[model samples]
Target: MGLAYIFLTSSWWQSAFNFLSLWLLDVPVNAYVTLFIVNGFIAPAILCWLYSFAMLLYEKIKNKILIPSIILFGAYEVLLIILLVFQPSLVGTVGENYIVSRSILTLIFTIVAILIALITGCILSYDALRSTVPEIKWKGRFLLIAFIFLTIGAILDSFSWTAIFLVIFIKIILIISVMSYYLGFFLPAKLADVLIKDIQ
Candidate 1:
């Protein structure tokens, strides 16, 4: 769990680095492209790999939850890969053109991705809450709340730029909240003991 949290945080930091590149270097396009390649594409791939290993490590206890989570996560990764591949086209005109391409194919893929993420998140949250560990429960609740706000903000962003900024702000909050939760709750010996026991 600590390692997972660390990788997740690192991914977000890479995202922050991309943001900084855009803001400070006045190289928005290149920065965005680089960010997409590194943080957006590669980061999620790494996460999927880590999650898979974690699932394997605790298969006996977590299989019911983790198996489905892994499947959904895999779907999410495929969608993310597709998104990354077509990123330039998707964002070609501020996502307008792609919006216009809202045909069955696009809609199906979009829904698949959204559903997988939503399901995986819910399962993870449930697992966290049901754990005997109090710290893990709290961390789960924190992440649950963050994801809720992030979802709302993302929905709102579909309306206007103001909402887009709100999405960005919410994402930052989620990142901070997750990082803090990881450091405070999951990085200690307690979490390590729990994880080791789970694996065993």
Candidate 2:
């Protein structure tokens, strides 16, 4: 995700003012447009699919609705990879671009993939929340909040410059939330028990 943001900032230039600067700098408009489509759009779309897979794995291991989530996630990844490889070229005139005819299809696929990822994330979050274990409750809450922030960030990208900044802020929050959840849930219990026994 950091890689995705770096690509967006350095190559795509998210701000409208930065976009205008391209004209003064003598950079081809199509180049920035292409970078936006490929890195800003497609790469993050692919990451969402990967995230769904990770959630599917967690569900299966934790004995949730394993098979269906895995199958759906796998299908999503396949579709995302296919769309990424066959992306319509933004460098040329719209109708003349390669894969132009398939643009609608790609868009539909991406939307479906995003929806699947969200659904899977919700299921995993719910499972975590419902666990009798205290550690898992905290982990689940973090996951739920992370996904909520991520969704908000994605929506913010469609709004103004301030919204874009909010998106970046939410991304940071999501990352930290997930990291802290894992560290707290996976490490503390066993390590604390070991340390207690050694002290005795």
Candidate number achieving the greatest TM-score relative to the actual structure: 1
lDDT (Cα, 0-100) at 43 in candidate 2:
38
lDDT of 1 by residue, 56-106 (tens): 345566666556756765675576557656663442222321111232333
In model 2, residue pairs whose N, Cα or C atoms come closer than 3 Å (at least 3 residues apart or on different chains), thus clashing, are none
The segments of candidate 2 whose C-alpha lies over 4 angstroms from its true place after superposition are: 1-108, 158-200
Candidate 2 per-residue lDDT over residues 1-200, each given as its tens digit: 33322322221233333446566884534533443453334434445445444555554554344455456555654654554556534221222211112244444544454455456556767887788765666666766665554455443332223344564675565556445434434547775466446756
Worst 10 residues of 1 by lDDT: 92-101
Residue 143, candidate 1: Cα error in Å is 3.7
TM-score of each: 0.48, 0.44
Clashes of 1: 0
Q: Candidate 1 — which pairs collide?
A: none
